[model samples]
Target: MPNKLVIYIHSGEPTQFSFAIVNGQNQLQNIHHHHDLLPQESFEEIIVIVPTEDILLTSVALPKMSRNRYQSALPFALEEQVIDDVEHLHFTAFDYQPDGQLPVAIVAHEKMAIWLQALDALSLKPTQMLPSVFALPYNEGQLQIIVESNILVRTGRWAGFASDRINFSQFLHALPVGSAPQEIEVLNFSDTSLAASQDSLFTYHEKFAASADFFPTLVQHALNSPGNLLQGPYAMKKTTLWRGDKLLKISLCLGVALFSLLFLYPTVSYFILKPKLTALNAGIKRIYQKQFPKSTAIVAPKLRLEEKLKKLAGGGDKGGLNQILSHLGQAMQTESNVKLKRFDFQNGQATIELTADSSEDFSTFTSALTNQGMLVKQQSANLVGTKINATIQVS
Candidate 1:
């Protein structure tokens, strides 16, 4: 996109705005002037450069004057109190004085200035927020000489012959025309008619030329210059126009495709393999029935047996059997004459056999098991030589 350029209209008695584009060599290309009433909303985007009385006075050779004298003499020339409602005013002075008593000038308009700032906030382009006088200065050449009077005329050799006549006032600054040596002459024509008067208060330097038809020539020179004024609004209307939801649209499409595949694939698989899966399940059930004749009745019993087996194998149960065995062993107080020969566990029953040297020894052993919460039942007993074989069931 091409760069944007904006120029704001100043506010004054006869306020207006003009602009021109100039090249690196400072030659004007195009010029345009605007004096039409602007919309209130349009004012928000414009940067106004209104005239003011506060002149920036400085000289290359002149001494700096006291602040009191400066204030008394200048006292901002623009009518400020009349337009106090306007906001956002700023002022600066550029002095190019080579002799005594430099002129002071201030540009302002608070409301219009703030409105232009609002336009900047909205990212609009405003290349130059300049006063009408400063803008008019560029209508000619390297040295712009403007003579403000009852007749306003701009004359310059390089500017190629142009003059303009208009109502003049002390409140306005004459536009700059021509270059350094080209003296800009200002004559007061408010009092006398030039046709009948013989006394002349205005004359020109040897380096400058005089002309009566300078306005149209000045305008033509501005048009022919290297720079031209930009048209329309300051900023491009649709540079980075946003378009949302693009990624969301793609994701939605993918999700729909995946959903369709999930349902369709599952349905297709079921139709293709349903019969085979059913046959396999039936065959497995038949094999199980053949292997276990009392399968229905013993299902619960088998679960109980599996649990008990897990406990015996030291896997699922928490050391309860070990604790019971340790307690029983501790309870069996050993009589020197009695010795345990074997211990066996089978089908939820524990068997203990002992050989005793005397009947007292046997009695003591039986009493120990009884005291330790074991249900003892003597299954068989035999005496042979010095050994006694006894089988006891511990429940």
Candidate 2:
């Protein structure tokens, strides 16, 4: 077992709490550090003990089934004796014994929320919680004790009784006679635990003041308690050695995906479209040969198609696309670095878009076209990244 810090939470008013840090080795780890803690103080790896009066501890003979199914049905089993709605409380059971019955502890949801919230403020999340009354050092019989003005008694392994001193006798009287402990042992015998009317039946003895180390004893008993309240919704998160590694791997995969989208998309598209581009070029040559059987050389399919359209236009006037292409193809001779990116013609108009060293080169080309008696208009254009992109319209 690891060293654990135990917290004993008291009831009412200003909310007092006690704590102790105990290590694993009984002989090597005898250092019992105990202290009272402020609500804002930080602690961790803890077990918490709540005053018994705040929790109803009992046992129910649950049906033999998976733990989840059993837990789901527990509220109904406890419905009759508890006056409030089951939804208002949190029910947690002890570790399952092969037997069907299990010890259960029930506390109000509001009360538990308050306790957990206080602990949360201090960054202390406890791994376990049990009723403080169970820390009374009880055996397989009756045990009675007094802490301050309260009477605490253990009637069974997973059963207990605790109430104000004023109500102890009446509480005891209300119990069925045969249901009393086979034997009752008293610790820290005081007026609250044994009234003149109540003590004669039980025996008591203490070599030293066991009450001096009340906080430490409570911490010990909390560590040794049979049941835990951190169950169901409040169970601690289960962590594994590889969780961080797994998270890093997922983050890396997502980062790779994002980087690929931003920088690698064009390369991926090139590979995907390269084969289709070749197939389309082959299909275009085949169609061109089918139309012009005499032409064995298929140097440029687009130029041949434009030549065919120009011949089909009767070759009388070089006033439209033919004039534009003729002049631009001549420009291509003088400016060897200039390349045509797109050539589109429609509705008695044609537009040429190209990339060049700078806008000045495109302006020189447009001036040259204007000098060639071609009606040319430089359209909207802009620089794209490292390249200068310009468009010109011819009609």
Candidate 3:
């Protein structure tokens, strides 16, 4: 008795669907035609009405048996009534009548899978499903029929068929004489014109305009009917804490985000920092050029500066000529007899020509240079009349 959604599937097409919302009071709240399956509201239960031609509403009488035995023998018992192999069809058996006739619904397994898959795509699962013919109002001793896009004829409480409007008479007359109704009433839901019965096979015939509340009316009858095709393997599975469809969508979105981060981070970082690196390199080049203005081939300015300093200091330190002069002055402070004659520098080495008061003074000056961590090599030496003259290399 809770609010429910009733979906009418047309022409075996998942996209061609219509639905109605019935409240707990059994009143029609909304109706939509050719509607998308996305529902804006919630319902306690959902019932689906499929095209009748796709469902085989028939009955079979069987000996009393346990539920398992009845289910196992159902397919073979109805095998002769269907054209397709029993293995390829799905069967749903209902309670037995007084005469032991079990009302049954049969549909192809492939068709059932397709319908369920379509509903699953929309995240919908219907609790009850039956043929559209059952939606017609039923009366005792009278046949009820409805005409819309197709013709639906309900001859008994649980018997009916859906056919094209053009073939209505052919199928109607094909019914067994003993089983045909004494009176027939037709509810026409379309603009199509209906002609009175001329065959005179029935005692009375009546055609009436379909009411504005047709969807709600049909939904009420369907809910009261005892036919549901969702049984055995076709029943809706219980939903887990997390729905499969929502979980899959979430996982796919996360995968896309991770891929974007991995693919774009390095490229974005390079573009963002490229300008800063360029500015720093430019500043270093300008400072190197300003300090050594006369130098033109400026390859590796830092290394070029180190080479210039080495030439000035004869490979000792970055203080250049000043450091070399400081060391020489200290070495000679204790050797007053040693006098500087000439000084020359080339290729990271310095040559000094010196005069000393005696050989001992010259020896003492060279030893002092060696003790100061400078490589001293005496290139030439001569004993003059009263003085010692020597040319030495220091680096």
Better of 1 and 2 by TM-score: 2
lDDT of each: 0.43, 0.69, 0.78
Question: Candidate 3's C-alpha lDDT?
Answer: 0.78
lDDT of 1 by residue, 45-87 (tens): 2223322122121112234566444433332432353243222
Candidates in descending lDDT order: 3, 2, 1
User: Which candidate wins on TM-score?
Assistant: 3
Worst 10 residues of 2 by lDDT: 26-35
Residue-by-residue lDDT tens digits, candidate 2, 149-169? 466777666778788757876
Over 4 Å off, model 1: 1-90, 95-104, 108-124, 135-199, 204-395
Error in Å for residue 325 of model 3: 99
Better of 1 and 3 by lDDT: 3
Which is the leading candidate under lDDT?
Answer: 3
List model 3 lDDT by residue over 207-252, tens digit each: 5566555566678787777677888887766545347877888999
Better of 1 and 3 by TM-score: 3
